[model samples]
Target: MSNLSKLEFVALDISGKNFLPWTLDAQIHLTAKNLGETIIDDNETSLQDKAKAMIFLRHHLHEDLKREYLTIKDPLELWNNIQDRFDHQKLVLLLKARSEWIHLRLQDYKSVSEYNSALFRISSELKLCGDNITDEDMLEKTFSTFHPSNLILAQQYRERKFTKYSELISCLLVAEENNKLLLQNHQARPVGTNPLPETNAISTRSKHGRGRSGGPHRGRGRGRGRSNTWHRESHNTKIDGGRGSSRQNTGRPHKGRVSGDKDNICYRCGMSNHWSRTCRTPKHLVEAYQRTMKEKGKQTETNLIEGAPNSSSPAFWSDTHLEACDFIENVRDV
Candidate 1:
């Protein structure tokens, strides 16, 4: 066997039972040969058959492995024809392993080869054709390019959308710091220098009256002069107005006689001090008045209680006296 065949045999041996079956391999090769003959002879095969053959080869062994077996010089050209052959999960797992291995080597050696290898592995495994780029850029682009449903799935895994670029950068910086701490005994340089003093700083005055613009005589002397003038004018005006009004009202002569003079008496009550309206009397005055009136009417056969000489008798009471008694009774009830 050739060196390449020997290598394939060794790879199959290492893979053990996980490797493709001999019978499946024969069938795939025969199918490929027939398909090739039909293409060369210009004989059309149904798209369905082509799809079925592709599925059969992919299930048995991936397109890349099949191309390796065919010893294709330019395998990338066959990538499209073989992409539908493999299990997507298996491809993703292989790509993930390759990506992680390349990333691990990146810390030791920063090389374009390592980066390209990682990219090619990831793109091939993901069946990603267009827009393959740097892993960091690719991850961001892929996250951005997801369909709504796929984005929701990614959110479930990542716990949030790809917003907060600053926060993400901060987290990355903190992670880098933690890694450095682990490797360097937790020591780090301080971030920045202390700030310089401002050039236009002002000195505060220590004494209360030291900084006055007019040297202490300025505000107080001017303020007192204005205040005294205003106060004198206001006080004089008030005093003059009060005296004038009092003199005008009091200069008029007294009218008739004072209301409570000794010679006068209440017309309704024969009281000496108060008028009839203000005289105090018992509450039963109305009933007593009615009874007296009724008695007078029987005796005189007329409503002559006011003009009768009997009304002036010593036992006779006045209407004002009755009213005073009623007022006293109301006060008692309250």
Candidate 2:
């Protein structure tokens, strides 16, 4: 009784719906147990082997079948009677398989795996019914069932002349994955956004007219070491009175003796008596100026004007002088 519970497959049902596969499982299990010959006519198997085969067969039978064949003690006779009773299943399965095969189309399934699985299942039934499906047949079936939009793609695959179905499926799966990745990237960062920079990933533009290395001409400095000295010397003479030094202000107007003087005007807003950093103008106006400076190729450091919040700057330029001469005339109105 303990061994009987170890039946390797489901018991045959009274309806015989699973008769074909149950027969196959029974044969293989019997062969593995060295009792295969007991089911053949006039076998010379020992009595012990015959008992083992009969017990195995009976254990796998439906309750109704067991009662009907209660008197049949011979394994060969029981096997033959069961085969004769359900043999018509082959004909029924073959007809259904043929219909499914006739209607099978790759385009009808959403993915290659699904279509391949269905094809293999149908082909398995056909082969069991003595109808073999070859590799060429599978490849042709797939090629003919591509969606109408993929006609050209199908033609290209056919041109590759793959002898095996697996090779074509591999290429198609790879292409599908790549296309998905491309779409994901496009959707992540849609069009008209800031384009990726091609060259010069480093932006030397400083937030406070200073470079990462803390040189005075940092933003305008170009070409390694000497540009720092040239920038400090050239720009300081105009803005810093040749002090060549950095000054930290408390956002206040710098004390000055003269008003209405040309040199005392703020370079940022074209106003008098205040440095660009300490000007009290609205932030939007300063941002507009920053944009204009960029449009005019002035390319100020990320700080743009002197008094904005400090943030990361953008790519620097080699030229030292600010190209604000023409635009400075219009700054007074702003």
Q: Which candidate has the highest lDDT of all?
A: 2
Candidate 2 per-residue lDDT, tens place, 256-306, comes to 333454568666765676677567755556678767666886555675555
For candidate 1, lDDT tens digit of each residue in 88-200? 43544556655653444322434334444564565554443222344455445434433565566445534654364344334444655676677675344223423333444
List per-candidate RMSD values in Å: 35.2, 23.4
lDDT of 1 at 333: 68
In model 2, where do residues sit more than 4 Å from their true spots? Answer: 1-3, 194-334
lDDT of 2: 0.78
Global local distance difference test of model 1: 0.42
TM-score of 1: 0.18
